[model samples]
Target: MKPIVAIVGRPNVGKSTLFNRLLGHRRAMVDDSPGVTRDRNYADISRFDKPFILIDTGGFEPVTEDRLLQQMREQSTMAMEEADVILFMMDARSGLTPADIEVAKMLRRVKKPVFYLVNKVDGDKLEHESAEFYTLGVDRFYTISAEHNRGVLDMVDDLMDTLPDVAEPSDREELTKIAVVGRPNVGKSSLVNRLLGYERVVANPTAGTTRDSVDTLFMCNKKPYLLIDTAGIRRKGKTVEKLEKYSVVDALRSIERADVVLVVLNAEDGVTEQDERIAGYVHEAGKACVFVINKWDALDKDNATFGLYVEKVRMEFKYLAYAPILFVSAKTGQRIGKIIASVDEVMEQYTRRVSTSEVNRIFTEATESHHAPLAHGRRVKFYFATQVGTRPPSFVIFTNQPESVHFSYERYLVNRFREAFGFNGTPLHLMFRGRDKKTLARQAHNPA
Candidate 1:
């Protein structure tokens, strides 16, 4: 459960710049593209031993004057409601304007902590010029330069220190979260209602009906389960595209927090490029997944239709070969009941752990079948292996030449480990650690 920190301000106030700067500054990290912050605003930021979500409510330029202030106020208010901590940034070069005063009035109503920041205050001269913004009557404000990295970290340190660190709820461990995601108008919400046996979420025929990811706590056979229903994700060229209005924060956040993801595909559309991108996201996150082909009843299918569809899905999502596929129709109540059982089975595999001796035995047998290839004109030697973690069952293999381990060999070992141990419906991570001292393991994408 990470706290969300949002940067809200008028257009051209360095919100997005600061958002991207904070992403790489101060040891914070995220798996996706951090530098491309044109409209992709939400990212999970892990910095200073504290993990939080950063959202930038920027990009409201080019609008008519009559709508700019109204839109800015709406965006700021919405961000304030969603964010646990708010960073209200202003441009010192442009000085304070009427729009800033209107936003500040709205911030005064918020009970949460709001930090004021004046950007573009590069040197001592600009710092003094920033004094004009004090008329907004803020308790305190810091002047800094987001581009050059001045006073940004000091503000974040104070914000993090002010936020109280609390333990996650004990009951959270009892719920197995499943996030349902797909492109527009894929029957995700309707399918979720069918699973819950009620209309917990509003279901409409139009595309983009659900704006936020809604959660519901349910029980089946005395076991608790949580379902995260999200809106359709936008596929922008080769990357996932999003704007401030159509933010997919909850969709990505649900995937991050869930134990399993339900990648819904429309039966009519088959496997579109957007569906492939959605599956890729789930795979990259290392979560167990199930492909649910919705609207099966609407399709005119014969005896061989299911086989053809399965073959097509296998060809498209070859990376998720370990995942199981289900052809269900929310309209006709077809095969939807099997979803929970499949999730239960996949959950077992996702959290599966293997003993160290068994791990070594598998490695020994795998190496006997196929040997490591020569790299850089040197022979690589494998000494030992051990299981270090689970949730994808990560292992560390000590070897003489970790950097020399071929990528093909890493993939081979992963397949062999999966074949020997029945770790279906989950990815495997095998890190190569060098036997010599002072050589840290540099493996990031080997066999994932």
Candidate 2:
């Protein structure tokens, strides 16, 4: 797992700006508006051949009653708790405020390593003013301008030295593979941070912040699992950068390798066509899938209304009617643990096997319920069925006329299999082949 470096401080201290600078792009939204980034932002950062996860905490405020403000505070506090090293940013131009001191006090209590970054120290005058922040008892301080990209590389170098080396798991075969995917800026990385108990990727407000496929491994309940954070998928015309173009391709490749894919969706936006397209890819790849409704705290829905949203999702993706849907607040770390349990359940289903007798029984009953279509006045005959593989639950069926099998008929059989044995959130593959030589000979000669 990558080391987590969290940027935390009072509002408008250039935390977001520094996050984007270290990430080598304008991923985080940069504006004069205080608390523009109310949610935690993350990105995978590398410097001098060493890599770590960077987190940009939302502006730290001293409010606890307002719901939204409380959510932001929780997100920032979570970042601090999970960080391997905390980058405590402060403004050199405006000097320190009471809020900054309060934040510093909180950081001092935590045993984790902390670095004081005095941002906006553009010239000698601002550099001289940066000294006042040393009273925060953070010990070391770095003077830099995040907007101008000055002294950012030095900070990266210093953080890289503090990161602990990641060790490989002993039982690689037992590792549960989970991929975090969604449309741009839906807190995919933020969710990843919660799962790994730290920030292993950088989160930003701007769309397409993550441009690489980052993998982090950790254990939940003594079972090791790998979490892959991927770039957001956008429509064809929306992508511009060469790096981003490759990143999208890499994200699809990660989906192919994943055992369970968590489709993260923004609760405020609801489901869209692009989301359906992404869901289609997971189904086509024959992988177990789960729907994660992120940022649920932002949605002003009561208990009854939230239930309706889940029902609507099931209606939209009828193919995955059996797949589980989890509503979570990545910002507040709400129900984040449930996401891991859901992935584990789906993975169990993916690797499950059925006996030959059970397979034949289900196939016979399904075929008897609705016979295969007639081909040239001859009814298609489906013979014995047997399990051939797992990790997608593949099967082979011998038939009198394999060519006569229709795609719709295959779908019906898959649905029947789901009904008999719970293959929730998992895709199934069925292969049809002729049992007799004459039937095979005819198909080979016709070449249709």
> Which one is best on lDDT?
2
Q: Please give the range of 10 consecutive residues that has the lowest summed lDDT in model 2.
A: 439-448
Error of 1 at 194 (Å): 0.4
Off by over 4 Å in 2: 1-173, 437-448
User: TM per model?
Assistant: 0.60, 0.61
lDDT of each residue in 1-448, candidate 1, tens digit only: 5687888877667776787687874211122222212221456677555777777663333234644344444545556787899888888988988868877887899998899999988999999989888899888998989888999889888987976685656675467889999987899989988999975555767677565565566799778888888767866652244431343655777788789899999999889998998899899998899999999999998999999999999999988988999999999899999999999988888888887778878898888778899888877878678778877788999888888888889989988888888877788888997765333232221222
Task: Give the Cα error of residue 185 in candidate 1, in Å.
Answer: 0.6
Model 1 has how many clashing residue pairs? 0
Model 2 whole-model lDDT (C-alpha atoms): 0.81
lDDT value for candidate 1? 0.77
Residue-wise C-alpha lDDT for candidate 2, range 105-161, written one tens digit per residue: 887789988888889988888888778877877668899899998887898778767
